[model samples]
Target: MSPGYLPFKDALDLPAFFCENCGFWQRHFTRPDSCPLCIDSRHVMPQRGWHFHTVEEARDRYPCHWAEVEPGVWRFFNDPIDGIGSSGYLIQTAAGNLAFEGCGVYSEDALALIATLGGVQVLAASHPHSYGAIWQLQDRFDPELALHPGDLSWSGALCVSWPFDDVLEPLPGLSLHLTAGHFDGHTVLYDRGRHILFCGDCLKFELDPADARRATTISAHKAFVRGIPLTPAELRRYRDVFAALDFTQTWTPFEQAANSGRREALTLIDTMMATRPHAYPVPLETL
Candidate 1:
């Protein structure tokens, strides 16, 4: 079957290849020879061989459900699932509901919850791996799945591609900044109205999340390591892009979030680059 061809009913049941290396889900009638997203050393390949899992295979063990992460934000997570622990967010906005990422795994409960919170109007991902079960999501919800023009080939289906010159305003007060790094079209959603930055692995947070003082500790090292480290040029460009935004709380696809204000988050990036020196360093010229 061609990509994005699954019917709404069949989509939720279609078999998809879940790449453990990059945490991406691409649905196809037959598995590809190799994971497309992992080809450029963007992700590590499995030593044993390529492994694929169907939605049905995982639903029993890793049930899908939703949780309220913040006042208006809800997180959809799967328990006991293999590969990277992937989570997607649904944020309530005046314009409509916005989802940060997608999970290949879906459930009736999740669909119900999404409907309860005003069905998602737009679903955007930061990178290819974060595309989640985009094909399925499109079939089921028919929401606009935003992708970067540069990463279109990385997509399994025909995605709604956007250009960097034109900013995306999914909602009245929310905007998505398509920055370069992990992928040429990597993005981070910023809610200008509430000062909340939804970073989809663009700005990674490093800390013992289990620690009680994780938020207050400024020593936590947070770098933009999606598949490869950011180049000095890309780092400087991203730094300036973020430097222009004012956000209080920033959240990622993983379990890391920075609540110490945007200034502090920016400072941490500066500190990490200064200390690491090798991977990321202060740039003399901006891109």
Candidate 2:
């Protein structure tokens, strides 16, 4: 059953709100006048003002789509994410399915498919921008919600059960790593068995045209639209965590996985540091 407008929290008629600019799905009944993420300089607040969608409006606007990008790895999202941030992921695991991030839109079909795969036992995100319709998922699955306490200030109302700090292996072969630069608690999911790193917002990328799912340029950023570069210490922290990983491929919130290895990952950081400290990303041509 997809979310409809009728059973809203109260008669105030505010229902749940979604920030179309940054994809922050706030489920609480109280309507906060402005989106907290949009107010921050790290994220650009559209001049047109805060664009919000009610549950019913969002479901009608964004259609549901899902695919197994790789074995045991699935991505489900609605189109026109645009600047709303990245899509959510459903990673099938032996312990249980882990739902990382939540699609801002809801679909009955997506919900039913997930049920057959065993409803999500764990739910988490790299940051608040990707915390789409998590409340809907929490309501439906009652999964164990997790968030690094660092981003807890931004996570509204959701009950967090298993919060991970530096590292966590909540499920077999699936791990979470904190590499805070984009935000104080920006994290990445590492699937050890597949040698893939879910980059989250920790890194920015442009997918190659020849190979729609591949990336030729990978860059680091404190904020992409603002063109802010991370401080040396923050970038170093990212390097350290990624160095420990043995991933040959990477995936961002909006883009598909790219054939980038650990060496290319480190070189991007090194190139950024040694030469252009102020440059958003050292530019793919130089890398």
lDDT tens digits, residue span 93-204, model 1: 8778877777656677788778878887777777776676555555666777666676777765534633444368867887888776667777788878778777766555
For residues 100-144, write the lDDT of model 2, one tens digit per residue. Answer: 877777688888888888888888888877787877777789787
Estimate candidate 1's alpha-carbon lDDT, on a 0 to 1 scale: 0.64
Candidate 1 segments whose C-alpha is farther than 4 A from its true place:
1-15, 161-166, 208-213, 216-228, 256-258, 271-287
Error of 2 at 22 (Å): 1.7
Backbone clash total, candidate 2? 0
Candidate 1 pairs with clashing backbones: none
lDDT of 2 at 257: 51
